[model samples]
Target: MSLKSSITGNTKVLCVIGHPIAHSMSPIMHNAVIQDLKLDFVYVAFDILPEHLEKAVEGFKALGIKGINVTIPHKIAIMKLLDEIDPLAEKIGAINTIKNENNHLIGKNTDALGAKVALLNAGFDIMEKNVLIIGAGGAARAIAFSLSKECKKIVILNRTEQKAFSLARDLKKIATIPIEGKKLNEQHLKQYLFHSDLLINTTSVGMAPNTNTILIPKEWLSSHLFVFDVIYNPLETKLIKDAKEIGCKTLGGLDMLVNQGALAFEWWTGEKPNKILMKNKIIEFLNLKQC
Candidate 1:
């Protein structure tokens, strides 16, 4: 049966909320799985302004929305608004998923789990590896917190140097790994990449409409590096293209996105959706080659 035809008064609601949410492929992958599994749930997206977040939560509670996937600006802000937070998400200071049970909201961060799974699935080992991360936003925080557990060293570079330093300091409190934050520049990019085994871009630098932009110079990349950019829109960012051209192993954000969404899916419905179906639905919708 079609998704619309399958929906009944009892069908549960699942959705993702964020500002500028039009770019999200969450609904595509999620709904595809919902339909594929014949589950009594419908997935959707909401373009929620930050100012209306509280009201949005109230509405979700009133309407008994079963699950919510938080994104972008809402990830950090929605924490205090929730009734309870998972411990790891609290440590990361961000949440990308929320479950509502009997009017109480519980928040969780699956981004870190998503990234770690994505890397390991791609055969990139993080054990004792030197890692270079770009950006100091929520995504950066989640990825850094996860990588800190196993990686030997981490250097975070952000356009605003203070944010990078602040993230580094925050991470140091919970992790024993050598973590450094510095201003993002060609000099530092070159210096860090020299010894780095993994390079992850947590920023939206090469997202759609600005696909040509690249932070690190092509010359800075080496064959020994494994580049992972968390932007999956274009499927391949300029940074990924450059790294690939230079003979470096690379992984795009599609897998990370799917893995995280899958984690949220299972947490919400107690059903493990076919991750391959979720991923391929997105790849087909984006009309792009598989990354």
Candidate 2:
């Protein structure tokens, strides 16, 4: 049966909201699992402007939208519009998932835990590990805050040195582990990545349409390091390919994306979605292999 033919007035609605949302794969993966499980839900996407967010929230409440997955510019701004915020989401200063119970929206951040789960599932443990993170954006902040509590130390690098320093300072207040931020340059990348146990790229350096650029050189990557790039579009980023060539275990963002979406799905519907189905849908949509 066609997706539209399956929907009725009683079907619950789940959606993702963001600016420039045409690139989002949430609907593709989410709707695939919903159809496979024969759930009474339909997932959709919206391109909501920043100025219309308040009205959009009101509309969602009136429409009784079951759940929301936030992305990009909306992640931080949507927190205040919600009825309640998870403590960890508040600490991370961002949220990517929201559950609405009778018009009461509760915000949560699943990106951090999702990344951690992805690594653990791949046989990597962050305990006592030294991590080097690239970029100081929302994704980096979420990952670093979660890793700081478990990892031995973390070094954040970004083009804007002060932004990295600012994020480091914020994390230091909440975590006892050593946290430092520096300019994203060849010298610092060489210095920190050498002894680091894990390398995480939270930047848009190797994103689609501009997938040729990489943050660090292949020589800088060691076999002891595990490289992770948080870009799921192209699946195999230049960094991931380089790391694999160096005999280092590498992870792309597809697993993290599926993991986070799964967490949100469970939070909204109390039922576990088929993660493999969700992942395969995205891979098929992107026409790429899961690295």
Candidate 3:
């Protein structure tokens, strides 16, 4: 809590709020942008449990907190607590970005936008690509809605058939793409992999201490396809490594984290974040920090 001056107090606050937030890299990512841009703002993390969300959001306004990013257990739950929900956030039924303006809490979904930017930043055009998103949780739903605009077709693959169908029903009204959801089984995955131009893993596979794990088999991947894993701990996921061995382009989750943080930084302060500096600092920080 470093407040420079009374005049700057209201403009200098931002944070990420969620329970078990020690796993978050938001501080390192956003702090780099804050310091590099020479802003009066600082981004911190608040470990707020589900029971405290309403109070926490109210505290944001009472204390004049500028904005925050919602993660994991709170993404969907925070929707009802907001004054207004952006169309993307409403359609996805989740919010990862929020702003406090005129004492009103406005929610937005930046994860999907971040994913879209990550795909294009890696040089794969999602516009006509057949996309397969693994995991039907909030992350899956957010990406499913955002990429729906760019992808020719989008499929949700979760372990449960019912959850998959539920997720599909929610997306039917938002995207023009042929959207569907199915239980991820051997047969289901085979058919899904065969037709997919892009395979995205939104689950916690290939993450820290689980670097050896992958959601899909290497042999099933296409040689000319794009394989993306939203896991950054191991830096190169098994899917990414295997895809690279087969000459398929790959993307890790770091870019999405940085891009989304950059956008959030811009939203909080009317300044462009130094992406290269932020990316390098994130990589450097994560590489050296203990898990």
Candidate 4:
């Protein structure tokens, strides 16, 4: 697909906002899809400070921005600023995509659905499986809540026991399956790793700048477990590497990232963008950066 040489005043704007937005691949992937579809839209990234979020959102409304993807610290904070939120997002307590419908911002969470899709596409069955999630943040909450419907049980493990318990308690209200929260320790690892069919790391422990660190001991990982780490910067985190070495199936966050962004793109443009094109663009960009 040919790139749109320039943006005109008529070019509708779509953007992603975060406190530290420099690392985002959203603009690269999204713009590729927009150009491929020949849409009159330009996507950009903005590093909006936490204090300036309200003003930034107001500016978006005033400027008639078509859509925006919220990342990082903004995901939860932006929820209160939006006019309305999707029921699932409200339940998950985070919103990643926002569509400005006639200046009334509508927030939705594509992360959960995106992860679910990615797992299914990878040939992993969530139904009747015991899932061990290694985080208590927004991503963990979203995945747990989304998988609650299909999985036999969910165990949330975090360094902070209370945070894990809080998330588990909140999710238990709507979850039909058994949910437990415990401190991420050797005992918990020994107890869950063998029985868990799936293990998802929503934490940033093995991301860039901390590339060598892995949350779980290599010996604890079983060949039967499916490992998923939501860290795409390194493409393969230490956890993913260790899991693969042990013969456990593994997946990185890039699939979820592209899938969620694709969902948001379709919702805003009412067209399904070429997802392969989007994924390739990110891979190419990351490769070039490495070189």
Candidate 5:
């Protein structure tokens, strides 16, 4: 173990496991909270592939590790490897947080609850609203599960209609809200965007450096709409900026990242991680590394 490791501390261990984890901000955001609160914890990233997930969890238990926050391709795969799944995680068919209680590996989905917190913090009241979600990736699935309880209707639009339909079908088994999946072609998207109370872009279309591509045309967007995009590298996506131009309330992925990490920290350590510290630390740490 590294000298800086808190493995010997009273608090348990925590890690994030994924492939291509070099770009992950989990350590920066989560470790800041650990330092700020003077908690005995260290959060690291394990760049393991899907095939290695079961071995990773087994090793955690063998090594007296406390818990982990999973991401990407491993989220769904880790579900079956865990001893228990939270209701929302079970409903969403995904896992982002895993807690190791001695030999038991428990699973939970913080992304769903995190998205709900992100939406409310963005001044959105999703209750009884018509919401349109873009992308059919893991993030999109989490957000859809989160909004299902509040939205009057949930419409998923994606380049791959089949994936969107798959997501809707999976979520319907858990959520009472009506869910619709459709292709995001010009005509179909325009119809949904204009009528949607909220437009959420979960795709990575407007990430860092590629900030010019708004998911939908700004002309079709209304000032009454609320927009959220899960891209934080540039901090603001083109969609968020266009939404701002049209006077639509908006949010970015940073809040979701922090909230979900916080929830995972709480789940493992039985303590709440500081949100502002987590957010600011991620920004500062990211900036410093770029320098």
Candidate 6:
């Protein structure tokens, strides 16, 4: 709230852009850190439709906005609009963070770094472990590509067999470990879940408004498995809750979200924001929404 008192014509602009931006907690979390650190920046959210992405990006360049975070429908599309793209982001086929440097926009993906940091902070080592990821979407691709070098094996399962196979093929080009893609079914789920050291859900099945639907059956989870769900809206998604009930270690997406935003914030400001403060602010905001 203190950020409002400091806004002026000279304040640098920062924002997250997505088609349906209302649900994003980035503004609350990022602004909290901005105010706490007393940075001359203001973080906001904008709902930019797919049709308006190009024009909106032009505005960012013209207005000298310090940086912007892309989400949802814009992450991949926005990459083509940037003046430059980070090599890692290019390989992942998506960019979530963009920096404006003298009118030149540079795009980067912080999602992988964020997820890795969150996993390590939670005390899970990726070294030589079998990782099972449910979903072959952009987030899954980032995670798989990021962990390919360390994990002993990576399995990607999706409802669409071809999509899963395609993702695996792409990952196999870079990953030294064995990477396989299979159709999501009881057989594959049971086989991988039984042997996997870590399980990550990158799909939106257990997100808010669809909180009742869980991709994995309760009986399939084992106490030895560690589950991480990339959904933070409900804080405790059904998958996370079930994993905990089964005595498996669990982590929600809130930490990953904060860490990614923190990486972007540091990239733009050249200063490290308080990650704990950022995460607490998001928790407080989400709790208020529940009320």
Each model's C-alpha lDDT? 0.93, 0.91, 0.83, 0.93, 0.84, 0.92
TM agreement with the true structure for every prediction: 0.97, 0.96, 0.93, 0.98, 0.93, 0.98
- Which tens-of-lDDT digit does each residue in 1-291 have in candidate 3? 332333353456789998889888888778776776667777789999999989998998998888899887899998998899998789888889998887999998888888788879889887788988888887788778878877789888998788889888888887777988999888888898889999889888788878898778888887867888888776778888999998888899888888778777777677888888878876786777754
lDDT of 2 at 29: 84
Q: Tell how far residue 240 is off in model 3, in angstroms.
A: 1.3
**Per-residue C-alpha lDDT of model 4 across residues 56-91, encoded as one tens digit per residue:** 999989999999999988999889998999999999
lDDT of 6 by residue, 124-184 (tens): 9999999999999889988888899899999999999998999999998888899999999
The TM-score between candidate 6 and the true structure equals 0.98
TM-score computed on alpha carbons, candidate 1:
0.97
Using TM-score as the measure, name the better of candidate 2 and candidate 6.
6
Misplaced by over 4 Å in model 3 are 1-11
Model 6 misplacement above 4 A: none
Better of 3 and 5 by lDDT: 5
Residue-by-residue lDDT tens digits, candidate 5, 202-230: 98898766778766888888898888888
Better of 2 and 5 by lDDT: 2
TM-score (C-alpha) between model 4 and the true structure: 0.98
Q: Give the local distance difference test score of model 1.
A: 0.93
